[model samples]
Target: MSDERTAVRERAEAVLRRLAGDGARLRDDQWRAIEALVVDKRRVLCVQRTGWGKSAVYFVATALLRAGEPGGGTRSATEESAATGPAGAGPTVIVSPLLALMRNQVEAAARAGIRARTINSANLDEWDAITAEIHDGAVDVLLISPERLNNPEFRDTILPRLAATTGLLVVDEAHCVSDWGHDFRPDYRRLRTFLANLPAGTPVLATTATANARVTADVAEQLSTDASGRLGEDALVLRGPLDRESLRLAVLDLPNPTHRLGWLADHLDGLPGSGIIYTLTVAAAIETAEFLTARGYAVASYTGQAEDADRRAAEQDLLDNKIKALVATSALGMGFDKPDLGFVVHLGAPPSPIAYYQQVGRAGRAVEHADVLLLPGAEDEAIWRYFASLAFPPEDQVRRVLDALDPDRPMSTQALEPIVDLRRARLELMLKVLDVDGAVRRVRGGWVATGQPWVYDEARLRRVAEARTAEQRAMREYAATSTCRMRFLRECLDDPEATDCGRCDRCAGPWFEADVPAQALDAAGAFLGRPGVPVPVKKLWPTGLEAVGVPLKGRIPPAEQTLPGRAVGRLSDLGWGDRLRALLGPDAPDAEVPAELVGAVVEVLKDWAHGAEPWPRRPVGVVAVASRRRPRLVRSLAERIAAVGRLPLLGAVVPVGEEAAGGAWGNSAQRVRGLHGTLEIPSELAATVAELDGPVLLVDDLVDSGWTMAMAGRLLRQSGAPDVLPLALAVAG
Candidate 1:
């Protein structure tokens, strides 16, 4: 090697040893990536397995770059900028995707003697100070979320400076940049613009352990661009075999969530160390955590819904071995680094094998042996379908968003919601997609049309959709395959060198019991069976409803609103979700309430009768919402409640037209319009309701928007019932 290359190599070694423990060293690929970044000054895409030290390459590169080239003397930050004619005037910038990932990265950076700061939604109060620190060159690494990249203040003013001044730009979890990526984020595409503005030869590095060959090529193409927006021919791609030998992989196809939870409860104590219990939904996470806690396991739920403080506390607890597990959703997926993590048990399969690989990669990082089990639930596909709906918007939705935007004036997402009836999250995602497509631009106020004619790539979207379907099928096949599960996943990732992992269950016989203990099963059944999630009364109307020509604005009057209600269970609940989903699923034949559901509601009302905040008054009568889809189901539930409580069953509140009844779509104001003065009591029903002396029960098959129950209850009250209560078989999540 040349003397200059040798010196750079020695410095990289020193940095790596510090970041890792004593006697630690880099693999050849790791050294190659560092060489490319610091010495060759080439953009590199590293696709290696977890625990392969992707972060080390960037941190060592940052140290080497910040310390100046191996030469006569280290240059000052400004002097280096002047000499190089570009690159960071300050620190390296990392576009992290998750809060948990950022926290872990910050700590890891600190151990390597690199001063790191994060600018994220959680630390808004500290952003100005952080910005100042970066400006003063006091920070070595700045980790910001992808969502933060598009912030008005950050994007318009601060990002260019940060981009131009960055010593090394790292896109961690780089798969998120590719639409074909399993966890694609629209915000990450903003890096295209961010990249275009960076100083030439800034040495960008994109790293991920999960990207397949296709995603690697896609992200590499993205990373190949320089500040001048010129795409290069080569992007120093470092792809490796993604096989974790330490993970003893297996799949447990339980009959349902109950059996899975029971198996977890029965076997958790047998697991070697503290680890994560993955769930499909937040409700499942919370439910699993609660059930495990009841079984004497020290566990907590970690999901997007968790408060930042609580999530931090939970993470620390697991790190400290203070908790046995954290039942979590994908919120805990990428960038969680725990070297000694001993196990990962998924309560349900992720949408795809690659996604499963990414999550299971969290375990067996530094251990000689770690158990990785996938508990494939019956409801896994349903959950997957629900999540798959959040992909890049269809052409019509995209066009709707663009049509709502005016190039002259920015419109906040809130203001555009009524104009275009998309939900907030979907709307934001659509806007981001449109922004990338050049149809609209997000500015200081909000988004504005760019007047750029954009074609909807229907073929491309169909390909993405098809790819997702293929992934789902692969996951199912993985569960059923007798071959090495690790090999199956590696092959799913399109690894050319995929081979049988001899340590996996298929290769070495089953490692876990197929049978859950009777005691554990009973316990799980009891926990799952005990149902009823409180349905908080909707009090306020959606904002901007009046400006959209709605008759009213602000809060709904107490007299018109129904009181806090009860549903047998949420459609997302692990225990009750399946039952509720079946009962309310589209094309589900509507009839009388099932006996089991009736029994569950009886228990709900029984528990309500004994609770501290019991019903304010005994229901004098029961009223069913006029149901076109499930008239029998609504009537049966009401009649059962009335018979059990010895209350009168007043006739249904029948509204005439579907236009007035409203389909299950639209925003709050539109729903109110559909329901407003639209519900009325027939003369016969009105006479019966008039004689009621107390609150009446309003029954429905489900409470999706809660508008049906709210309006129907108000009409019953107007008919002479003193107050109204809503009772639904299921509450849509």
Candidate 2:
């Protein structure tokens, strides 16, 4: 090799030694990636396996491009170029997805003598200081969350400088940039703008362990451009075989959720070093962790809903081997660096093989062998379908958002929510899509329509939807396939060099027993069978309700409210939740309460009666809400509760509205208005309530937004009942 090339290789070795250790060295592929970025100044896309040292390539490249020598340090702060800002200092800007991942990246970068700093939602207090430090060239690397790229303040004020000066731009977990990716985020597409605005010749590198061939191509197309504004084919694709030899994969088809929980409880002790217990939902993660902890396993729950401090604690506990595992959702997916993690167990299959690969990739990174088991459940598809439904809304829904937005005034998401009838999350997602398409702009106050001619990319969206459907089918096949599980995953990801390792259950036969101990099974059953989830009463009115001409705002009056309610189960609960979902989901017909659920409700009421703060008096009467969807179910439940408790059954609350109230759509305030004046107490029921000396139980089959219960209870109270206690069989969260 030429001296120039030899020197570059020597520099890469020195940098790797600083980041890793004196013994650390780069593989041929790793060196090639660094050469492309640091020497050739070319944009590169690396689609290697999880433990292929992807991060090392970027860190090594950053050291080479900025320092210009092996282990060379930074120049004095006074020498920093004021005209070009921090890019003059040649700092690497990494766009990361998860806060946990960013934290890991910062620490990893620090080990290599790389001066790394991060600006994310979790560290707002540090952003100004970090940004100033970047301006002064004190920071060598700056890490940012993808969502920050689109922030009005950041994009308007800070991004232009960072983009212009960024010496090397890195898109970590690059799969998210592609809509074809399993965990697509609309904000990630905003990276195109960041990429477009960079100064000419800024080297770029995108890295991901989870991209399928399609995702790789999609992300590549986005990264094809350099700082000079030239855009064409993928910069350079270096995809390698995706199979991990250290992972001994398997799938166990448990009979039910109870059995799955039981098997986990019985077998968890046998797993090696601390790892992750992946769950399909946050509630499931918490439930699983709670059960495991109760069963004497050392574990903690980590979900997006957790506070940053708690997530950090849980991550640290796992890293320190202080806990056996962290039961988590996809929130814990990317950028976690645990090399000796011993096992990875999934309570349910992810929606796609690509997503599954990304998550299971967390284990066996530094181990000779690690167990990767997928406990597939019947509910996996349901969860998949639920997430699929959140994709970009139909054209009509998009147009409604456009029409609601006046060019002159910006509308906050909360104000648009009650008007457009979309939930908060879906509304925000729609707004993000609109913002990207140039139909609207997000400003300091809210979103404003740009009046741009925006066409719904129907064909593209349909294709995406169809792709999700196909992926779900593939996931099911993965569970049922008798072929090598690793080969099935690789094939699903469209990896050309797929091969069977003969280390999986399908290839080598079952490595784990499918049996659960009797005691464990009983405990799992009892744990899941135990039920009672409180449905808190609605308190504050949704913001901007008056824009829709509803006068109500702030807190609801006590006299017009339902008491803090109780439900036998949440639709998302692992225990009785599955049964409740079947009974209350969109297609279920109005019917009497099931006998089994009737017993569960009785138990819930009995527990309430014997609790520390039991009802002031036994219910004197029962009142059912007139239902458009499940009248029979509501009436039957009320009758059962009244019969079992030996209370009088009063007439149901009648709906006097122009149309039936309550729906799957709409925000809290809109829901409140729809049923605000609709529910009425009949004169006969009024007289009966007036005579009652105790509170009445207002019954419903399901409590979704809680508006109907509040409205119905208000009518009972107005009709002279002393108090109203709301009860329901299921609460849809």
Listed in order, each prediction's TM-score against the native is 0.95, 0.95
Task: Report the C-alpha displacement of residue 581, candidate 2, in angstroms.
Answer: 1.8
**Over all chains combined, what TM-score does candidate 2 have?**
0.95
lDDT by residue for model 2 (272-312), tens: 88899999898899999999999999999999999999999
lDDT, candidate 2, at 104 = 86
Record all residue pairs in model 2 with backbone atoms less than 3 Å apart, i.e. clashing.
Answer: 87-165, 200-227
Q: CA RMSD for every model? A: 2.9, 3.1
